[model samples]
Target chain A: MLTRRLSLFATLALSLLLVSGAQAADIVRLATTTSTYNSGLLDYLLPKFEEDHPYQIQVIPVGTGKALRLGRDGDVDLVLTHAPAAEKAFVDADYGVEPHGVMYNDFVIVGPSGDPAAIDGGEDATNAFATLADEGATFISRGDDSGTDKKEKHLWEEADVTPDFKGFRAAGQGMGEVLKMASELQGYTLTDRGTWLAMKDKLDLEIMVEGDTALFNPYQVILVNPQRYDGLNTQGAQALAEWLISDEGQDLIDAFRLKGKALFHASAGEKIDPTSAVHESD
Target chain B: MHELMNTAREALHLLLSFDPALWEIIGVSFRVSLTAILVALPPALLIALLLARVAFPGRWFAISLVNTFMAVPTVVVGLVLFMLLSRSGPLGELRLLFTQRAMIIGQILLAMPVLTAMLHSTLQSIDQRAWETARQLGAGWWQSLWVLIREARFGVIAAVLAAFGRIIAEVGSAVMIGGNIEHFTRTITTAIALETLKGEFAQGLALGLVLLLLALVLNVLLGVMRGRGHQTVSI
Candidate 1:
């Protein structure tokens, strides 16, 4: 009798787990970056998007590379990321389509208040990086193959410097954790403005350099190609992509702020040249 | 069905290559769990002894608290430790965040409640006359404690094994506190999480297979040891 009851309870528990697991897949899966998720932009915008739509969106925050890979694997219905080259590669690979401009933010070189590298307010990000490298000031790199990490590598390449010194620490972590490491170590790091503004209060670092055209960061949303995967919620993903670029979405992006400062400048509904590096001055 | 066969093929290829990355993750998982269980053992055993043998005010409440703590989520522990270790936190001066030490500390907290609760029950169910007889035979307090522990050695071993199991299999706190930094704090479970999220099913399944094999080997080792030298406790 006891064994019979034990088997029945075990069966009930297993079936309950199965039922819940099945219910979880009813929503649209969107893979996005940590910047959008951590900066509270998604929290502000997703509810508004879901209000008029039939689908509830599930957001998976990961690095740009992983987001694209998830899109390629058809594990997620769509992706929103900021790495242009990688995003283009994903599109070229036939994994995603309809890449729409969502918003724009810029990267800033943040460092200690004392400014040991003395590159504060520099117009050229590469020049500032060269100075930091020459001075051997401690620098933290995300090193996680994130979009931010890719941007930092581009700046290093432009600066003609190898950031391989002992002072350079490649922390395979998120932007917020990297900022904390930089703060504690009094090091310099490159971060998107959205994450910086959201987490600035907790950090002692300041923006040492900004306004370089290369520092411009634009976000894009893309729907996964349904032809490559079976049973994908392609219609749901397209609806989300469409809603994000709508006038309501653009206005919501413009209005979302962190501490009275707008985190992302809205650029939706604009005819953005896909190849153009930066649109800030234009 | 085809994916399963492909994953099996990939797992075999990874295993046959004697891959350094796979072995490194397995090593990290074992090292972290071992360090955490070792660090927690003395304190957990002491707490168990105190709760089991001593009759004090609110002892039942303390026992209930331990029972409750055993069910606490790993993510909650990770979040509390993450805050404490963040640069803006009060203890941030130590700069211990995102390090292997932080991962070990998180795992210690994750495993401690399991160890203490299991060992507490183990000590409680032991024959109380064993302690009394040890004392009557001129055994001192420390000697009597040791005698009781020895009498309940099998249960104590089981508790240690259970704690090891809990910490080794945990992913939430390890990812949050450890940051899943590759070549630094990434364990088998965290690597599996990263790979699975990145859509690298083969690598994730390979690490998962390693974790399962490790658990199987450990349980078998425990069974053999139990049958050889120590009398088994059914519980």
Candidate 2:
């Protein structure tokens, strides 16, 4: 009886795998950042993409560095990440095709309600960071070389602060986990606004600083160069790329919201200026 | 075959270099899994003894429940823990999520069922006369319980070893609860997953080889313990 039951379970599991396996053959592998994956954006976007597109998307969420590395290695057919400089470098090196701007979001500095560093009401992210460094305020960095991490590093450089203070921590993980750590420790962190909005209710941390032009973050989708790697799914990559910048995809991205506030602004056809000013007057 | 050779060469280099990053990952894996097993050991043993010796009403059901848990996928355990430890969950106030403590808790949950179920069968296999004889000799409850455990010492050791094997290499719960923070919660398995996703197969393969070596060492220890158990029983 035990053997029979075990076999029955095995058969069920195998059959399920087989069903999914049939669909897996038509899968289009896309390497993306954890921010896009964790904000529940991909979960909302992929189903719509699948309904119209011929290929199924298998989204692998990692750091921006890793995502670009995957593209360079031809491990994935396409890449969707927010690190514009790295994306540009990858395309410039001919590892990937030209990256199309998909959407734009801004980063926010979130911390405890008391706002220990007095960075609140500041439009200058660099100045706020410099003050945090000088005060030795407990700041948690994503530290994973993610797009958010890159922005934080850039802000530190712009602020001319070393960020080597004793209170600074590098939680080398995704954006959501860093948010949780910031809430638990009451430390400050830089995060993409979409993820911040999605998880704000559950966390005690509040947006302490915002509306900085330096905080602007944008996302891009690039097709991995098929010429570099054999067995490359160029057709699937092309189709997905074309569909993303299409009217339908832009509409879907524009329609996505959290807590009645739109998380991202679609910028499919336009060149995104990284230093574009965010709405501070609101 | 060429890829395999290259991976083996890389694995050897990583192992020989005494790489701090790799060692740190190993340290996290050992620290979490060892602490989990130690926390789980006493309770699992006591429960196994109870289910083996006591004439409880729901004893059969209890045994069946334990056996059922043995089949629970690691990912399901991870998902359950993730929800419970997330900022929105009931335990959110504790703020234990994304910490080594949370991963330890998940590993404890995972190890308990395997330890209890395996040790239960070992306890059952011990002769009932061994307990009777201890009692006949005026042995106290604690003394007799110790003797009974000694009788199944090899089996208990094997059970502990098996539990360790199940958890040390588990990725799902570790990644889910621990968040795989580098220099913090990243274990060998989580690191391997990350490296493989990044298309760095050499590092992933090296980590895989280390896991395989760990399993081999554990099996060797189990074999030695079993031999000693046989000698003691014969004498």
Candidate 3:
């Protein structure tokens, strides 16, 4: 009886696997950034894609570093992420092909509403950063090897003062998470505008300083190098990439708004000034 | 401080409230680990019996190899499994990565050797007279197998329980192979890692408390089993 019951269970499991295999062609695997996942972009994008296509897309969103790692491992069919240098390295390594610009956003400094650092003035990003260092105000860093974390580290490097003030907390988390930590601690933090705008309703923090050309963050979508991983779903990935670069997709990106505010601008084509005003404004 | 206290109180409320996700996680943990043990147990017991009762060449070397696997960490198990299951890996065509089956495979690899080593000791400790008496009483080799199995049932059960405890609580194997995808492979430990990263302390604390309770409850169950075993032995 025990052996019979066990075999029955095994048979059921085998049938399930068979069913999954029959639908393998009806699936596309995507690896993307935690920002894209946590920011609710994939949640919004997937339903539309599923409605349009018979196949379901399974998104595996990790940190930018991990997303690239997944692509390098050929664990996913496509990747959507930021981190220009890392993306370049991936493409150069022949792990990804045909990388395209997806959207544009910027990083900003947010702090307690009380302005404990008195960080607001017609001050440049470096001076504002120096002010925070001088006041010894707590600042939370998203030490999670993410695109945002990379940007924060770069900005601190540019400030040239090695602003390692008291409470230099590296939380090693996502943008939404690090922002919440900042809110709870009422400490200062660097955040992407998209995640901040999405979460601003829940936060009492104010944008202390932004307008920095050096803080512009861009997102890109890349199809995995099919030659590298023979099992990659190249046709489906290309189809998705074409849709993203198409007029309808670009408009959808431009149309994605949060709390009566636009979060990102389409960066598919058209080369206008990229944060040149930020330097002049400062 | 008040916020922290409020959050802790809320966490307790959610835990006692029997949230659906909590139970789903517990069920998944039990089902996966249970399936893993059930799969590993037969082969493990067979090997243990063969190693203990059968005389064969290089049997000691085989036993040593199994013992060596007993010390292999879950992370290494996960890495090796990831390669075996990934798209570019040797078994890439299988596409088992991020699936529950892959998790079970990891768990089986995780639990089997430990189970074998444990049951080997259990069988070696069994009185040789029990099997000999069963055979003398007109029992065949198969019947004597059952007789010996019954005699060492306590230690066997303990072996299974310990293996279950190990896999159910393991994080590295679960995350790497299962991917800890939400509403999918997110076991208790991986979920705790994510929640703690999000600084969602109430949820994190609630999950941690549940994991703690599970450990405590399993320990109590083991103690009771031992107590009951001692009583059965005396009887």
Candidate 4:
């Protein structure tokens, strides 16, 4: 009986290996932020790409810090993330190449409808952060070092307020989880407009602050340095990155909307001025 | 290979340095799992005793149901608890979601079936005459039950340890309901999960080492207990 079972196990393992090996070269590993995945943008875009291309894009949704780290480590073929500073650092270190601006979205400070910090409709994210600190209002931070987390730290630094307040919660989780926690605790949090729009109906939180030039979130698609690692599907990565910035990809991004509202503005090949105050065209 | 070696060396250094954050994660794991096992013990024991000793209707069906629940994945448990404790759910008024208490409750649910199934088999393995002898000697029902439990003390302790090991290492429900909040609900497993995602291998490796050491210690204790139980039975 044991011999028979062993033979069956060996056959099963061999079949699994054959199945995976058949499509190994056609797979492109793309590490991206949870914000993009949670906003349902990739879901809308990747199927179209796969329908036309021979490559099957395997998306690894993580925080922006981890996403960029994955690119640096050569663990992924490509990365798509929103943290421009980190992306610049990655490219400067020669860990990545061929960076392209894929799209743009703004961050918003969301809080309970009651607006305990009383900074509703505030244009300055830094001032709103200071008010939250001064009022000792509960704030949920995405302590996971995500793109939004880095932006929140920048805002806190600009406000010159230490985030060691009594009600400051460092939730080492993704954007969606942080938003849910903020709503559950009636706390405030900074989130990308895409994820906020996608999950707004399910959440009780409202947009308390917006339109800050400092809140600009620009996304980039970059390829891992092909020379750094062997066996990387560099061609597949280039194909995906090019498709993301191509006219077809740009149009698809512009047309992808949630609840009849566009979540991302395609900005392929455009020099992005992050501090330029650009309002969302309703 | 060189990078992995350096990470392992750093992990060892971190483990020896007594990092407060690392120890805090360890403490959360033990506190939540220990409380879960302690809370689950009494009810699990009672249910096991009932299934083993009592001949109620559908007794076999209850045993099968418990064994079935043991196969339920930990993430499914987390999803169910997440919904129940969600702000819009029925029990949302308690405000227990994303707290240590919520994690404790999740672990309790995860621990119950394992404890019940293991304890039932332990109680079943006891000599049937032990209970009868205790009762005929003028002991009450509860006293007789205590005697049977004492007769199976080694198995009971082993069951508790095994269940504790299972819950302490569980990351699914803990991550979903606990929210992996730093200085609050970040257990060793959840911390390892987050650190690995963040591409920081040293902390993840250190926490992995802690879990490995714990599994070794628990298994060793279990082996010794089984040996002692064997000797006792033979004697």
Say which candidate scores most in TM-score.
Answer: 4
Interface RMSD of 1: 3.2
Per-residue lDDT of candidate 4, residues A171-267 (tens digit):
8888888899999988999999988998888899999998888788788999999999999999999999999999999999999998888888999
In angstroms, how far off is B132's CA in candidate 3? 50
lDDT of 4 at A205: 95
Q: For model 3, how does the per-residue alpha-carbon lDDT over A113-220 read when each residue is reduced to its tens digit?
A: 999889885436767778887788878777656777767766776676574577576654567756765775578988878788888888869998887767677787
Candidate 2: CAPRI quality band: incorrect
User: Positional deviation of B87 in candidate 3, in angstroms?
Assistant: 47
Interface RMSD, per-candidate values to 1 decimal: 3.2, 3.5, 14.5, 1.3
Candidate number of the best lDDT: 4
The residue-by-residue lDDT of candidate 1 on B147-235, one tens digit each, is 88888787788788878988999988897878676666778888787656445678788888887887897787667655643443442
Question: What lDDT score goes with residue B41 in model 4?
Answer: 98
Ranking by TM-score: 4, 2, 1, 3
Candidate 4, A8: how far from true, in Å? 34
Q: Over 4 Å off in model 3, which ranges?
A: A1-22, A161-163, A270-282, B1-235
- The two-chain DockQ for each candidate, comma-separated, is 0.20, 0.19, 0.02, 0.51
| Position B9, candidate 1: lDDT | 91
Which runs in model 1 stand beyond 4 Å of their true positions?
Answer: A1-31, A37-61, A75-78, A98-103, A116-121, A130-140, A159-173, A180-187, A220-223, A230-282, B1-8, B125-148, B221-235
Model 4 residue runs over 4 Å out of place are: A1-27, A44-56, A239-243, A246-252, A268-282, B132-144
Tens digits of per-residue lDDT for model 2, A28-107: 89999878887788899889888887788889989888899888878899999887777777888999986799988789
lDDT of each: 0.83, 0.84, 0.77, 0.89
lDDT of 3 at B69: 97
Q: Which lDDT tens digits does candidate 1 get at residues A144-236?
A: 777888788878877889987657877667899888778876889999988898888888999998888888888889989989999888888
